[model samples]
Target: MSTGPVTIAVVAGEASSDLIGADLIRDLQRLNPGCQFVAVGGRHIKATGAELIQDNEVFSVMGLAEVLKDLPRLLKTKKQVVRTILSSKPDLFIGVDSPDLNFSIAKAMKKHGVPVIHYVSPSVWAWRPGRVHKMARFIDGLLTLFPFEVECYSGTGIDARFVGHPLAKQIPLQVDKQRSRAQLGLSDKKILALLPGSRNREIKELTPVFAETVRKLNTSDEWQVVSSNVSEAKQKQVAKLAAEQQLELNFVDDTSALLQAADFALLGSGTVALEALLSKTPMVVAYRISPITWWLVKTFRMMQLPYYSLPNVLAGDFLVPEVMQNDLTTDNLLTACREVINDPQAEQRMMQFHHIHQSLLTAQPDQAARAVLNLAESLC
Candidate 1:
């Protein structure tokens, strides 16, 4: 056994992935004193004592068109990151989400004989199923958040483990709506939580439509609309869009609290939808990518799954209404909200949320960390 500290190279390119990385790093440090991390991530991972090579913002863009626009610079950064990680001579490499960037870097590390683990399986099961074979070529192990994802790696020769979702454990099975509302200074009126998205491009694409939805909803005092506070610049952009629709929205910093207080969540199709589900909040998920990207996806028949939202994907059914692309008009969004609000089966839906939430709870908190270190030791 080695007496010296073991170094782990990591890359977590989004806020959600950063949270996962932070938890994993904390466990690794607790189990192995002097466990060091070199990473690419945001505040959460950096706060865990990882030396960040670059801010996560560089790889934040999504969709084919958006990624292409920043490809040159992203490629430059990736090359630099690859060189830095290789030179670090890490005992192990962990790529947390952001498969677009991490897979390439993981491939490089694998070529150099570094044991590679990919945290958070990409949506290969949902689309581009062929990615499973590609991943088998690089990663020594795969850590998946959802249970169903492990089945996707069967026969791929990758040691895939279902570490359970961190959020499922972090969020209580039952939420106190009134208490969360009191904390956020929210009224008892039907609360509508709007989370356009975290990234600038996502906010820009969705804010206008969201603002219009608010404008239509403003016709009556039945709804009190709120949004989660994002970056100051993005907040200002949202305000500008709302102003164009002659509407103003209240912004709160605690998204989890807001979701708990909300009677209904109107948000983009991403992690926030999962948050809303775990909060036991009814929601209508909406999303719109760039036109070219949408066209390319459609023309090429890239999407293997009918649903896009995390909750829906997890359930393997359309558990919630998904308003998307050209269909994501203000009228449609409003109608979906109304449907969720008036649905007779709302309580049944909450029961389903409970079922899914319970399904994601792992008995051990350190499974991910233990799995990573076990892989590293095996390589030696």
Candidate 2:
């Protein structure tokens, strides 16, 4: 074993990535106490003792239009990160989740002899399969959150490994809903947890539709309608909308706890859907992006998939309903949610989720860290 300090350069752009990056760093430290992490990360990564080179927000935006608006700042941040990383010449570079932003950065760093390990394979199996060759040029190791992604990289000459997802192991197979509800002081009549997503763009697009759907629920007052926003600003926005619509809703701060409390959830199609599934909460996923982004995705055939939500995709069949764009209406959403809420099939769905949960409990961080370190060692 090498006695010298192992320096790692990491960039994690969002909350989910931050959590994974943090866990990876903690496990890497366990493997080698002399490991030093230099990163651009959010709270979770910082909690694991990384010296943050920049805040994760510097690269946190989604959709074509949103990214276009922040392109200049993003470009500048990439240059700054490249310069800083080159000066130190770390043993490993780990780009977590933000492949749309971090892929180019990793490619640039590879020119300077830094071995890059990208955590969370970009949805190549679903779309953009051509990028595997491009990824192979820079990424020495590709760590995946899903088991299926490993086969997607086969014959592409990329060293891919499935590290599983931390959420699977973190959440218990059975969530104590009654205790969670009591903790939130929620009353018993059909609790609905609304997760509109964590981004400002998501809030702006989905909140009105969700607010309208909340209004249309039968015996609305009997059912406790609650939403958890990612920011205080979004919570305030939901509050204003609730007042305008004359609806009663509890806006909570802790999303995980809210997922535990939910009998079912109306969520935006993203990581939250997976979280809700991990909590064994049946959900109706909905999303509406800017028309430009929607048009570009359709026009270019960017990421055509049979199912968009993680649960449905993982199951290889429809376990829940996911409505997108114009179909994500108040009436459609309300109807879909009601059907899911009162379904006899929900028990089977929950059982399937439990099996998926167990399958995904493959100890993510240790596996991911070991993969990256093995690549680093081979490079040495």
Candidate 3:
């Protein structure tokens, strides 16, 4: 009996990871045309011809309340996945982000003699540094976005690589603000980009404050609000919120363009912050996960990071103001945005953002694909 073409199993549970996973799949396909992918992914990875085992996005949940609400379904899905992966082992199993979900899948697949590679380094450097110990048990290799992340794997013998984020290459080093605004059909009005987040629960927690901030900022409609909505519901939610406050937002799906067109941004703290940095759009960040989630996190002291936003973590300093939780108020957000917009250092900060972008550029998809392939070859 002959083994057919190399078969890899991948699981990417979030939109960001889906994009990274798709890029990786394309590059892997280029190198090994006959390679087959059995995956738990979303639209992006599916676009690359990966066979779907499950829609990974369903497993993505934020806040303790939300997770608990969906816990029964999550457990059921987890068991179903365990059975799926173990039914027939593939050459390699790659888990992309959602380490909470991915690592569990990896552990199961690892026991079945599958070489396990995790695409994103869970913020062990930021929180629960102790996870470095557990990493050795399941993760064979870790593909990281930032070069500094390699330090997180210091004591662990786990293989890690800095593949560089694809966005650094995808987004232009310098965006033409005039062109972007022209394309978006905006006039002399200063643009304030709003990126609440993709998840409904996150929008629920943050959009109210975001609406208040926009209302305060748009006095006399001096600034045109441009918000990016990840889903139709979020777009409608933003619309409802804007209508309630009598605010006008040029809601668009093309977030990158909006980021490029904006004078500055007010966004929820997450991957959008990273995207803002790549777009060279100076922003003030905020987040509110739920009261119970906040209490539990504080009670347990779960997070170990000095900063919350990706730009701050990457720069090792407060690159932009992050007003999280209770501090995320209209007055505070307005102050931060005005400070950034009016400060003489605005250009200087954009320059710093440019430097950070340069630092993130590398042989992306190819290097990442090769790393995964090599790990699988060595293990299998």
TM per candidate comes to 0.95, 0.93, 0.93
Candidate 3 per-residue lDDT over residues 1-380, each given as its tens digit: 01358788888887778888898999889887878888888888888988888886687688787799999999899889778866656778888888888888898888877888999888887778899888899988999989999888977989888888877777888888889889987787888887788777767767777878888877777788878865676688877776676766678777878988888888887778998999888898899888898899889898888688999998999989999888877888888888887888888898999999999888543788878777776777
Candidate 1 — which residues are off by over 4 angstroms? 1-4, 185-189
Backbone clashes in model 3, listed as residue pairs: none
Encode model 2's per-residue lDDT on 93-138: one tens digit a residue: 8899888878988988888888788989898877778888888888
Candidate number with greatest TM-score: 1
Per-residue alpha-carbon lDDT of candidate 1 for residues 113-187, written as tens digits (9 for 90 to 100)? 988899999998878899999899999899999988999999999999999888888788998888889888887
Backbone clashes, each candidate? 0, 0, 0
Indicate the worst ten consecutive residues by lDDT in candidate 3.
1-10
CA lDDT of every candidate: 0.87, 0.82, 0.83
Candidate 3 or 2, higher lDDT:
3
Give the RMSD in angstroms, all C-alphas superposed, for model 2.
Answer: 2.1
The residue ranges of model 2 lying beyond 4 angstroms of the native Cα positions read 1-3, 183-189, 363-365
